[model samples]
Target: MQVAVINRSHHPLPAYQTEHAAGLDVRANLDAAVTLAPLERALIPTGLYLEIPPGYEAQVRPRSGLAYKHGIGIVNSPGTIDADYRGEVKVLLVNLSNEPFVVQDGERIAQLVFARHETVQWQQVAELSETGRGAGGYGSTGTR
Candidate 1:
């Protein structure tokens, strides 16, 4: 899949340290000066604008290394980037640690994965067919 990206700043993106990496790493735009404290969350700008094709979306995800090492992660986890949106890619990060987290410019903040999604079509019916356990929800069956 091909995606259109715009670099608002001159800062280069962070490269993955290992080969055969699954996702492309994104960095924070240090010029924005975004910071967060323990149990706090902030929206950090990446300075990257994307143009995703129709029928597809870009999923903004957290890097495992950053989540594990810094005790920080994406608040929405896999944030959905709509194909029609033509805006700067920003990351909502939450610091779960006790210390304040400083997000420097050009720091690896997140990863983006492009995926295709199908548009849903709904149909209305007067009555639906019934099954043995029809309309059962939320542990209607025995736990054992």
Candidate 2:
């Protein structure tokens, strides 16, 4: 689980925990500032780069405190970072509040979690087995 981080600005790299950690902290770029108006979206630089091994992916997620308090959240919640991508890690933030939102440097913008997955192959079939609740969606069952 080796990740390469690029310090674009003079700011130090954000701290990371490896032992039963809840989330990977993503910090805002101190060099570049961000301002998002109501319902506006902005691509925020994290001033970090990552190197993920094959068969694994880094999922970018929004912080609950930031989203609930400031009305700011990741535009693409749980954005996927492919294993083979050797690009800088960036976050897309959207301000859902009524007023403008200012993003300062070193601010905890989001959280990233690394997960491993397997690529499954799909097979064509003429007919599929039906289940008891086949095609039931969106609260179709009784909410007990």
Candidate 3:
């Protein structure tokens, strides 16, 4: 699906590294580097504005390589960009390691994944249909 976007950064538009990648890698748009102390979080800009279509959302996700190598992660894990939102995309990154992590300009800091979503209509039901393990939550179903 084609999407409408405006890029104001020096870096190229977000792109999929592989032929079958689910997300497009986004870069950090900054004049200088940002250093994040351990356990610290910062909002980094991408200089990207998007017009996400209705019935869809753009999710900001962390790169597995960054998380595994530098302990960098998105503060919201999957930050949601609603269809109606029209603003610059920024990533909230947190340093989960013991040392500081530097966020360089044009660095691939996060990923943007576009996905379709459903709008929910409230039924206001008195009860939901019951089933086996009707009230089970979380680990109720044994992990196999």
Pick by TM-score: which candidate is best? Answer: 3
For residues 70-114, write the lDDT of model 3, one tens digit per residue: 999999989999988898999999999999999999999999999
What's model 3's lDDT at 84? 88
Q: What is the C-alpha RMSD of each candidate to the true structure, in Å?
A: 2.6, 2.1, 1.5
Indicate whether candidate 1 or candidate 3 has the larger lDDT: 3
Query: Any idea how many clashes model 2 has?
Result: 0
Minimum summed lDDT over a 10-residue window in model 3 is located at 135-144
Candidate 2 weakest ten by summed lDDT? 9-18
Question: What's the CA error at residue 69 for candidate 1, in Å?
Answer: 1.3
lDDT of 1 by residue, 16-114 (tens): 557977678888886666668999999988788888899998888998887888898999989999988998889999999888888888888898877
In angstroms, how far off is 48's CA in candidate 1?
A: 0.9
Total clashing residue pairs per candidate? 1, 0, 0
For model 3, the stretches where C-alpha displacement exceeds 4 angstroms are: none
Stretches of candidate 2 off by over 4 Å are: 16-20, 30-32
Name the regions of candidate 1 deviating beyond 4 angstroms: 13-17, 126-142
The better-scoring model by TM-score among 1 and 2 is 2
TM-score of each: 0.83, 0.88, 0.96
